[model samples]
Target: MNAVTRLLRDLVAIPSVNPRLLGPDVETPAEEPVAEYLSVLAKKHGLDVSRQAVLPGRRNLLVRLKPSGKVKKRILLAPHMDVVPADDSQFKPSISNGRLYGRGACDTKGCIAAYFHALCQIAKYKQRLQHTEIIFLGLIDEEHLQSGSRAYARNGPKADLAIVGEPTRLQIITAHKGDFWWQLKVVGKAAHGATPHLGKSAVHQMARTVEILLTEYNDSLKEKQHPLLGSPTINIGVIQGGTQPNIVPDTCSIDIDRRTLPGETENTVRKEILDVLKPHGLKPDFLDLRGVPCDALETNPALPLVQRFMKVARRRRTLGADFFTDASPLASAGIPAILYGPGDIAQAHTSEEWIDLTQLEQATEVVKRFLQEVES
Candidate 1:
């Protein structure tokens, strides 16, 4: 097996599932093993590596390559290391029909392996005056609130250009949707179900509220459209109320997922939702919002580096991605970033996640070629 294939197999064998997505007791040394493995390889190749403590135990691994001459261009390569929880049996790697299958096979161990392979080659044997300094970061907590990226952006070194790895099938993605999470709780009086008129029903109130949001709010969102990303979306993901059927529900709660466009902010979108609900006299009682919102990505496609990378990859068409990635935090920090990597986004997080070998090879070549063209 080649280097990329071998690296991906090893990555799949290690379980680095995100702890935030599972029960409290269910925790693995998320990304520690992967970072160690990469560190060993970096040392073996005579490259410098550093680790930053992101959470208590979780860490972000970084590799910086200094230019032979004065640095003229700065580039960042960031790929997340966490994956959603999966069965232990799914961690076993399998190859069938040129596709490697396992947990995180597509949702980014493939990209991580590919990036490592290309970086190793670039570090040891690039035969030209290097005017570019490249920094590769393997981040933590991308499957949840993207705390890793946020932390890195706040404290890490800045770059002129960055590529946040994702399963984009080697496409150059310049724009994508953002994510906003809100937890809403409604309170009412409780009494006997038989004589429901004695007490107000929180379940009833929630039903009416959800109905209006589904019809009116969803319809109104269509008018606010983006050329490549299309329209923002709302998903009422979770709803819970009442303990028993005999008693009227005293409280009802729901978790709202709002997919924002490039132009929207947390405050502006929340205000719009409030405007819709104000007429109905329904306001949030205990709404818990995410501390940081993942803003939509919209890097100027006209950037010279972007245009040059596209030419190097021989890709003429640029499109928007539907999924949020680490690019959000990096972009929000003023780094001109885009998402690009192997494997289809559809295969990510699936039960039988896999990546085609051909695509992996192509993606590795693309990374190498793009790095080689970083001239002063």
Candidate 2:
């Protein structure tokens, strides 16, 4: 097997699932194993490896390939180590029909493996490195709020480019969407269900609010379309209200997920929703997301490095996806970041998530070529 494939298999063997954040007991967040494992690999490959404890017991690993005492460009290679929870039956990695089936196979383990393979290939020619420095950062908590990326970006070494690993089928992604989460609460007086006229129903009020917000959301989609990223979207992912079916409930709540574009802000989006509900006498609280928001990533397509990479791929057309990634945090820090890697995003977070072996190999080759071009 190729180095990338072998690395992917190794990554799959390690189950680094994110702990439940809202369980009965506070699940201690931990991701040390993955960090330690990556560190070991980096050391074996003769690269300087380091770890940062971004959270208690959770660490981010950084591996660097310094230039051969020259002034080459710098590139940041980043992949999230923590994977979302996997079903009990899907904990182990299995290969079938040239596809690797596992929890993080499509979401990011594939990218991790591909990146390592690329790095391994580059190591063979370390003496030829011109003026480039490649830094590989394996982060934590991307499945939740992107804590690792935020922390790393806050105190990270400056780099010219950041290639965030995701399941992009090896496409160079310059744009995607951002995320905004809000929890809304509606209050009303409770009364018996039979006393229909005697009580105010919070559920009924929330229904009106939801209706108006959906209308506004749909209207905004028609306003303008981003050249790469099409449009912003809104999804009411959760709704809860009432106790007994007959009682006029006094409280109702909804969790909204708003997908934004490059120029959109949380305040502006929240204001649009609030405006829709204000006139209806439906007041609700907007909650802040506990983690980092995945902002849209837009890199200069005309950059020398980007253009060179594209030439290596020999592809004229690129795509923009709707998924959010760690690229946002890195981009916000003034790093030209892009989302690129192997596997289909459609399979991510699915019960039967898998990554094509061919895609993984292709991605590894792409990473190696891009690094060599910039490094040399």
Say which candidate scores most in lDDT.
Answer: 1
TM-score of each: 0.94, 0.91
Best by TM-score: 1
Candidate 2 lDDT trough over 10 residues, lowest sum: 20-29
Off by over 4 Å in 1: 126-129, 191-195, 244-246
Q: How far is candidate 1 from the true structure (C-alpha RMSD, Å)?
A: 1.9
lDDT score, candidate 1: 0.87
Model 2, TM vs. native: 0.91
Clashing pairs in 2: 72-131, 72-132
lDDT of 1 by residue, 201-290 (tens): 888888878887889999999999898899999999999999889899999988999999998987898888878887998875546577
Model 2: per-residue Cα lDDT over 1-376, one tens digit each: 6667777877877878876443446564446777778788788879889877777778788898888777557888898888877776665788889998988897898988888778967886664466788889898888877888888889988788888999988888888888888888889999999996899999998898888778865686658588888888778889999999899999999898888888888777778777767777877887775545666777778877777777776667666878888888888988888888889999998899999999998888888888877744
lDDT of every predicted structure (CA atoms): 0.87, 0.81
